[model samples]
Target: MQFNVHIGAGAVLASALAAVGVWHAYSSGWLTPAKPRAGLAINERPPEFIPTNGGVLTIAWVKAYETFEKRSPSELELKVPLGTVKVPLPFGETVSEVRTAAKYQYQVRLQKRWPIQCGDTQCVVRTGPVELAEPVAIYHGETERKTRSGWARFDKAANLEQLNRSLGLALVVRGNEPRNRDVGMREGRVEIEKFVREWMAKEAHGARRIVVLYPGEQMVDGRPVPAH
Candidate 1:
């Protein structure tokens, strides 16, 4: 016995069309390209965490000269917003406020540290770096700040002015994405929060992280919480 197998012209044409569509999509980066994904987690038996000494931290945002150059954040930068600031004494020991700027370079005034009596001749009152609760978003331009009519800045300024002596926090700006800056700030804030949570989990310090996001302008734990 002999058997014959045949395929319909319609079926062959449909397959060919599907194959071409896929090829076109792949070449156009619709199917072939993959977006970069970020993952966050705590490590087991992580190294000892050291806090940056000082009651104040200065944040500066500079434009990137080369797009290809990798960003090398300092130890303070990596461990911040999650790391504690080593403050001394009962006088102005708490963090008062956190600030950020889009200017190329700027200086911040931190509280003066206690006097360290060196030898017998002179006593030195030195100020060190302040621990950051979160990494500041330094956009290439003031696109977000300007577009929002400095709404984010206004929030920060208000929060800092009414800041309490107990808790310190970095504001996470979220809400509508009318532009690119809005989206950038939102994503950056998410990453910063993730980094802090990961550190709290991995570091062996046995510390708990508490985050409160307010929908509007409201105070939580003595700090102003901004919402979307």
Candidate 2:
């Protein structure tokens, strides 16, 4: 009995060591880059969602860059709206309202975060660098601000201005695409709702996200959920 107990303990200890070894291997990214990695392929594409009543919502991603490198998001560019809307971000509110091409509506601002650790997982995610997506845009204004940078004057005046804040026209959203009298647009509404749910699950509080609602593409006079 004593001998058997000793053997069992030894086996269990060995198994645990093996398991820990495997976990560390995974988390530390020891088994990656089996193939030569030239570099990470960085792609930034906006995800679009179509809803009922001939409307579409596009979730464009914005990335922070050297003040000049990425001035505004190209994917979802917004022309200056006629009026600037000042919606409130009530204390402890995940959703807020702003002027659309039309009126006021609620949009949930969410943030996603990933710990930058070793180089392997870093390479995969940084390839796309999703966590940094935001409302990036270039806007036209009255004048440019001149500032000294590394012994040089730079022209910098690109931001969406609100009552007290400088906000960018971050996202482009439209209603259903023009209905082709030929091909019927499929109902992808259920799929879209699922996506938002998943994004919410991953997004934490106080994180801001941009949503654009499209209203007029499918219908003759579709009213879009304007993202101001």
Candidate 3:
């Protein structure tokens, strides 16, 4: 009987010790479920969304073909007090012509300050002046030259050579002219509008309708018009 009682007491003591150990572990947090790692939690917050504003935009080279022609004087003239006297030259007149293809680049300075107005679903953005991104590029490989010399001309070859040498420089000068720049800008206007529309759609703060205006243009009757 005593042996059985002792056995029962031993079992009771063992159960109590195990219960105490379990309580201690619970209090120490060793038995609690592990906390999620820093970024591995199922309920982690996401980053905030931000929209992008456009930067500088550039158009690739636009191709243009032009013909330049020059005619040299047939005779030398001597200036006098009252009038000029013409003296026939040994070499007659030389007419030289060159046909060349040039490439021009256009750019929009979006990074600069530009006016912007927004309505409920529409936005109007005034862009900077459309400008040349680089000097005109002439394709020499495609240059075509024609020279015609009069019957007595001896320097036809030399005249043609001089024209050829100055062709590139002359074309560059012509391309920089105001009228030529206007033509180039007009040529690229459609593409520039399309590009701006697409870009504004992405960056104009949920604007569904985008209107772009270049320099020297104004909003007229809800449309764009060239400023006088």
Candidate 4:
């Protein structure tokens, strides 16, 4: 009978020790329930979606004008008994005027990615740069050309041909001027904002505000700060 009583006491004591150990572990967090991994919970939110349609986006178009001119000097002169007389020469001047409509494209290339930051209510997208598309479309029907010839000048045709040949390059240079680029960037900003808003409506359903930053812009205090 004593042996059985001792055995019962031993079993009770073992149970009490096990209970105390478990309580200690729980208090120390070792026995607490594990935390769910990131993005694995029952209510996990989806990632923010940004659309990059495999290539560049045409954001805006700017109109520009360029004029090319060339002049050849008259070499013929008449010498009289009293003095020398100057005569009008042919083909003395040529002018070629060109008007162009240039397209500006925006792209987020792999080398320089546009960074996008998003919150529960707003999203900010930073753009890389705005560039003029190649082969500026010239308004051929609106182009004007003029040629003048002096009675003594013989290079009128050559001068006009040269001016015409250089028109394409001149227009390209004019289209890329700082003034035109500034206009394009301003217009592009509006288009980009609109695009982002539309994208948010479809992809990031809860975002309410969209801010777009140009190459030299920044966000400060939830407002856009223009570059100096």
**C-alpha lDDT score of every prediction, in listed order:** 0.33, 0.29, 0.67, 0.64
**lDDT per residue as tens, model 4, 1-228:** 355534588899999999999999999988987787631334444444465644666777776655667765555445434446645324333333333343433333322233456666667677666667776676667677777666555566777788778766766677678787777777877888887777667764675788777767766676777656
On a 0 to 100 scale, what is the lDDT of residue 94 in model 3? 84
Per-residue lDDT over 1-228 for candidate 2, one digit per residue giving the tens place of the 0 to 100 score = 355534588899999999999889989998654553322223422332222232223323222111212232123223444559645322221111223221112122222432211221111111111121234233333223332221121222222222114323233121211221111112222233344445444543123232212222221122222223
Per-model root-mean-square deviation over C-alphas: 28.1, 24.7, 18.8, 11.6
* Per-prediction TM-score to the true structure, in the order listed: 0.19, 0.15, 0.56, 0.62
Candidate maximizing lDDT: 3
For the record, the alpha-carbon RMSD of candidate 4 to the native fold, in angstroms, is 11.6
Question: What range of 10 consecutive residues in model 1 has the weakest lDDT sum?
Answer: 64-73
Per-residue error (Å), model 2, residue 194: 23
Poorest stretch of ten by lDDT in candidate 4: 104-113
Q: Write the per-residue lDDT of candidate 3 for residues 27-77, one digit (tens) a residue.
A: 998899777763122454432222335565664456678888878876753
Per-candidate count of clashing residue pairs (backbone under 3 Å): 3, 13, 0, 10
> What lDDT, from 0 to 1, does candidate 1 have?
0.33
Model 2: ten consecutive residues of lowest lDDT:
121-130
Q: Judged by TM-score, which candidate is best?
A: 4
Residue-level lDDT of model 1, residues 127-208, one tens digit each, is 2321222333344443221111121122333333444211112221211113323343334434434543454456443444
TM-score of 3: 0.56
